[model samples]
Target chain A: MFRIIKKSLKIGVVTGQYQKGEPAAVPVVPEVKKKAGLFKRSFAIREVDTGSCNACEMEMNALMNPVYDAEQFGIHIAASPRHADALIVTGPVTVNMERALKDAHKQTPDPKLVIALGDCAIHCGMFKGCYAVTGPVERHIPVDVRIPGCPPRPADILEALSELRNGRP
Target chain B: MPEARLCDDVLKVAFPAIRQNAPVCAKSSHFVVPKDLLPAITHYLHTQPNFRGRLTLLWACDHRPVRDTYGLYYLFTLEGSHHWVMLSTELIGNDRLFPSITPHIHAAHWYEREIRDMFGLIPQGHPDLRRLVRHEHWPKGMHPLRKDFPWDRVLGRQQGEHHFRHIEGEGVFIVPVGPIHAGIIESGHFRFSVAGEPIMQLELRHFWKHRGVEKLFEQQTLIDALPLAERVSGDTTVGHGLAYCQAVETLLHLEVPRRATYLRTLFLELERLSNHLGDIGAMCNDTAYALAHAHCGRMKERIMQLNDRLTGSRFLRGAIRVGGVTRDIDNGRLTEIVEELNRIQLDFSEVGAIIFANASLTDRLETTGILHERTAWDHAVMGVVGRASGMDCDLRRDRPFAAYDALPVNVALYRYGDVRARLRVRGDEIHESIRLIRELRGKIPDGPIANEPSRSPDPGDWTLSAVEGWRGEILYMVMAGEGGRIHRCKVRDPSFVNWPAIQWAVLGNIIPDFPLINKSFNLSYAGNDL
Candidate 1:
């Protein structure tokens, strides 16, 4: 127990301050509105992987790590869509997961936003003509934001979320 | 090539039938056998005393336009031998029925089911013929891999039912998990039958991320297919990309430069180090040890950042091209890698000591989720899971590729097949990978990084490339078509073989401990589904 405490103390505060009005690290599709703050301060997100290669999920998980420390901005990954204020969907929306993605979107209560998290989610990217894929995430449900990268880095993901939280482009 | 002669001698002595008639097509290590002799030959090789052959790959290809037949190939790696023997047979003339080898070889269960789903080929007298890849929503009698099925065509959904094995008892009940999970991970479903708190049976329903990857490979040029291979499983970008490139190189008869070979080895080890660190942290997180998780996560991030600095991608994508590598590391970057690895090794040892000292964490890992050696061998588990269960197989040491033939590799083995055993195997491998990278930095040669192919491969040319990815052996079998197009590309990720082992590992463990066991194996959903 002492060793644990000592290690924690030695690590100190590694979290970085959330910078606002900075240049976007990753390009976001259709630009964020300057004054429509759907999630004011605290943001609860439920990540849904419709069909990804899982690189996007890896970057998303990095947000919770000590360096990015997304929880410091009152952003947490909710266990269920019902408890979530936004749904972060990844992948190209394979046929097998189309129903589940819709169900999760429906399950999330009113005034919720859907953010597509990767190039695959935005336009099906490399998996464009795949027969098993239904299309990009927007083909099934409405998407409010799109984070574009093969997989956007964690810093890019945190920046987009902060932009959404602060209602700043 | 000498190993092929050895395989020929061994097979002729054991089975006189092959000696009586010449093989239909005898290449370096590939043989064409009569369709009826496939099951017998595979069974003999798998169980023979002096030649304990492990079934490495089983895949079927649609050869409709070229030949009115479906081709089935069985790949096996003999114990203590550097060569792999491939036996293929043809199901000709509207006869889609082939003999089932799964009755004798348990590892062929999933492969045969996948063949049936993709080609509509019936495995004669197989026990279970249930759907493996195609879910209930897929329409009946529609096989996507056949030449007649268009690549971009979408079929309407149909009503279908998947039958789960039902268990009935007084206190027994079923718990159905998700195609959509809570955490930021890939999609897969798990069904656990629990009696009180302990699990009696666990059934996994995967393939929720299948994107017709193999079908998409057809009609694509060899260069264009490399990106698809890199995306087969995002985390294993380097492994799958190297295997695909190696297969293409072998088909084109191109020799990679010595510097590129060493660089490939260096990148593969870095990929391995990053994944092992992440998995170690995830295993600890599952056990509620946040301190270890944080430290390991930080170490993993550093390695990933280093990968981005050296090669332009965090996952090492586009680093490997056909016949060679795309980027070269300078001396200064090599020194940086050595220094960074030294710092990581020191930090890792300290974290390892802390993890060992924590009794509560160690208690949860010890003796929990034990997979018997017999079960492991029967299922033909690969990689860390197989090593943890005492299956002495590491493709890097046994069948060397890249720069592994010159550099020595120490395979980590643990007799006990528990969560702790898996953890220890990953830890040892992390150290080994760091050592390999440091050695590579010292001895890396100066030369061109890539070799360009002069001409296109012949229409019927085909070859196999196997790389021991961080997870396990990733196998790619590539066949060339007219105008240098890829006729068929069969990808077998290590997760395809290791996923089944998880069900056996979770038996008798409590339902809550399932996450710990699953994390230790860390199988890929997209890789397996594809």
Candidate 2:
């Protein structure tokens, strides 16, 4: 038990300092702005993976790690859709998950931003024209932001969410 | 010599009506049994001790344009050898009445059900021929795999409720969980029959994520199919991608360079390391031990970041191609990777000690979700689940493809078949994978990363390649089509065989421990659903 406390204190303050607007430390940000508005408030997101390879989901999980520490940025993946301010949907949206995707969108309270998290969510990605796929997530629900990549990195996801918090949408 | 004798004996003794015998690969053979003798052949192979016929794959293809009949293929492997015996038969002109082998081979139950749903081929006397992949609402008789059903045809979502079997008793209440889960995981429904806490029965319904992976493979050239194979299961990108590439390389008779083989092995071990670490953490978290879980997640991210640094993708996507790997790990980078992995191992050991040291954590893990040794063998479970249950099978060791043939792997085994045993297996494998990466780093020879195929794969040529993915045995069967394209590609992820084992494991366990036990097995929903 002594080792736990020692290790905890040894690696002190692992959370990122996002308040200083140090975007360069994180890799590859497509947008930069020295603005402060809705960034002051906490944001809750509910993740809905309609149909993905799960790679994007892995990155999303990484946001909870000590290095990323999404909680420091006032972003938490809430358990219920009613608590969420945004919905992060992944995959090309399979036929089986179309109804659930729509319901998740409908359940999220008003002023909810829908972000398409992967390439598949953006435009069906690699699963185009397959019988099981029901096309892109946008076809089922309106998406405010589209993060494109087979899977966007955790840092990129954080940057996008932070940008959302900044009231850029 | 004994392997060949076993294959020949099975054919000559049981399948005297065999019309043609062809070599599928160096270690595998294809036998075209007469349609009338298929049931006998399938039954005999499963019953015979010499054959030890473990049904690995079963699927059918519509040969209407050419042969005017549907061709059904069943591949099986013996207990010890790497040799595979493929039995195939033709059903004349949609007369899809083939005798079901499930009455004898319990493992072939899902495969037959899938065949009935996808190809509209009736497995005669299949006890429960319920729709497997099509779910509850897919229009009856509309088989998606047949040539008549266009790949892009959208059968707009049909509305219906899935019929789940419920126990009718006074105290037996049914608890239904998820086609959409609360956690950040894939969709799968579980119905548990609980009689005051202890689960009397559990039935799982998955395949909600089946996005026509096989159909997508049919649409791409072999060169472009690697990315789709990687996405078959997000976590097992290297395993599935390497298996697909190896199958293609075998069909084209192309020999990958030594350096490429070593690099592929490196990437595969890295993938394995990341997943095993993450699983260990998940299993701990399910038990409410958040400290170890968080640390392990951070370590996994370290490896994932390293992956991005090396191959531009966190999940090792696009790292492998048809002939070989896409990137090379130079001497400088290789040394650096070994050093970083060693440091990670040291940190992992520190965190692992805390996980195992806590008696409270170990108490919940021991004797929880126990899958018996006999049940594991009967179901033919693969990877860590099989290993934990004392089913001694690792494709990397048995069938030695890529660098595994040159570099021996120490297979982790246990007998308890409990949550702890599975956790112990994963823990041991993480160290084993790290050792393999370090050893391969030292011995990696300098050479070309890939070899250009001399010609396109010949039509009608078919081959099977098996890789021991982080989960279990991943098998790929690729057959060449007209104009040097892929005709049919069947992927059997390790989850395909292990998912059934979960049903057996979950019995008698309380409702609350279900998540912990399920995380212990940690079957891939995407891989299994696909």
Candidate 3:
């Protein structure tokens, strides 16, 4: 127990603050902020992996790490869709996961924003023409934001979430 | 004596039915065996004291438009030999049936079921011929891997219900979990049959993320399919990418530069180090040791950032190409990597000491989930899981690839076969990986990063490549088609073999300990589903 406390103290605070007007930062718009009424102060996201290669999920998990510490920005990954303000969906939406994705989206309350989290979710990425895929997330449900990368880095995901909180779409 | 020749002599005497010998690629020898003789040959090779062969891969290919046969290939790696033996059998003339080897060899169970789902082939005398890859909604009579089925064809869904094995007892109840999980992980379902607290039985329903990755490879050119291979499992980009590239190089007889070989080894070690650290942390988090999780996560982040600095991608994607690596590491960057790894090594050792010293964490991990050696062997489990259960198999040491042939690797083995055993194996392997990277950085030769293929591979020419990924052994069997297109590319992630072992591991353990056991294995759903 003493060792644990010592290690914790030695590590200190490693979290970094997001800089203003960073390259990953989205431009804040007034109209977007007006629409994000309940999500203005804090954002609770529920990440739904439709059929990702798992890199996007790794980055998402990294968001909770000590370095990223997404909780510091008032962002938390909710345990369920009902408690979530937005749904961050990844992957190309395979046929088997189509119903589950739609169900999760419907479970989230009204005024909920859906963010397509990766290149696969945005445009199906490299898995564009595969038989089992049902295309990008937009094909099934409405998408409010799209973060593009084969898998966007954790900082990129954090920036996107900050934009969502600040009412920047 | 050459290992292949020794294997050939033994096989020739044991089974005279072995037909013409096909061309050998790398350390692998190919032979065409009669369909009837395949089961006996495999059974003999597996049980023989001198030649204890492990079934590495079993995949079927639809060979229409050129030949009127559906080919089934069985690849085996022998004990104490670096040689690989692949036996090919043909199901010809309107008969889609092949004698099942699952009854005799338990490891072939999932492979036989997968062959049935992908192709319309029927394995005669197989006990359970249920759908392995295809979900219930997939239309009946639709085998997506057939030559008739187009890569982008759309199909209508049909109503079908998956029957879960029910155990009827006084206090038994079934707990069915997700195709969509609560956590930010890949999607797969698990059904746990429980009585009070202890789990009676566990059935895993995976393949919810099957994206027809192999069929997609058919539509891509040889060079264009590297990204698909990289994405087979996101965490195992280097493993899958290196396997695919090595297979292609062997088929085309391309010579990789010595520097690129060492670089591939370096990048692979880095990938292994990052994943092992993350998994060690995840296991701790599952055990409610958040402090270890935090420090390990920080160390993993540093490794990932180093990967980004050396290569463009964080997961070491795009680092491997057909003949060699995509980029070269300069001397200064190499020095930086050595220094960073040294710092991480020190930090990891400190964290490791603290975590192991904590009675609460070690008690939770000690005997929570135990997989016996017999069960692991029956399932042909590979990588850390296999090593934990006393299966003496490490593809890097057993069958050397890249710079592994020159550089020695100390395989980490443990006999406990519990969660603690798996944890210890990963921890040991992390240190070993760091050592390998430091040694590789010093000895890396100076040359071009990649080499052009000498010529195009002829149609139907194929080869198998195996790499020891962070998870385990990742195998890729690439067959070339007309004009340098991929005819059939069969990918076997270690998860495909190791996933079933989890069910056996969680037998007597409590339901709440399932996640800790599952996290220890850390099998890839996408890789398995694909």
Isolated chain A: TM-score per model? Answer: 0.86, 0.82, 0.88
Per-residue lDDT of B1-530 in model 2, one digit per residue for the tens? 66686677657765566855766766777788877777778778776776777788887877756678888888888766757778888889648798888887778888888888888888887888777899777766678878778889887556667677788989889998877777777778899999998999999888888898887777777766888899988989999999999998988888899999999999999999999999999999988998888888888888988998899888888888877778787899999999999999998988888788999999999999999998887787778998999988887788887888878999999999999999999999999999998889878899899888887878777778889999999989898887777788988898988887799999999988999999998888888888
Query: Model 3 compared with the native: what TM-score?
Result: 0.97
Residues B54-161, model 3: lDDT tens digits:
888999998887998899988887777746778899988698999999988888989999999999899999999778788888999889999999889886799998
lDDT of 1 by residue, A67-94 (tens): 7778878888998999998899999999
Clashes of 3: 0
Instruction: Report how far residue B468 has shifted in candidate 1, in Å.
Output: 0.6
> DockQ of each model against the real complex?
0.66, 0.56, 0.73
Interface RMSD of the predictions, in order shown? 1.7, 1.8, 1.4
Which residues of candidate 1, in runs, are more than 4 Å off? A17-22, A25-38, A167-169, B1-7, B19-28
Extract clashing residue pairs from model 1: none
For model 1 chain B, the run of ten residues with the poorest summed lDDT? B19-28
lDDT of 1 by residue, B116-177 (tens): 99999999978998898999989998788898999998878999899988789898999999
Model 1, position B309, has a per-residue lDDT of 78
Better of 1 and 2 by DockQ: 1
Docking class of 3: medium
DockQ of 3: 0.73
Model number with the top TM-score: 3
Q: Top model by DockQ, which number?
A: 3
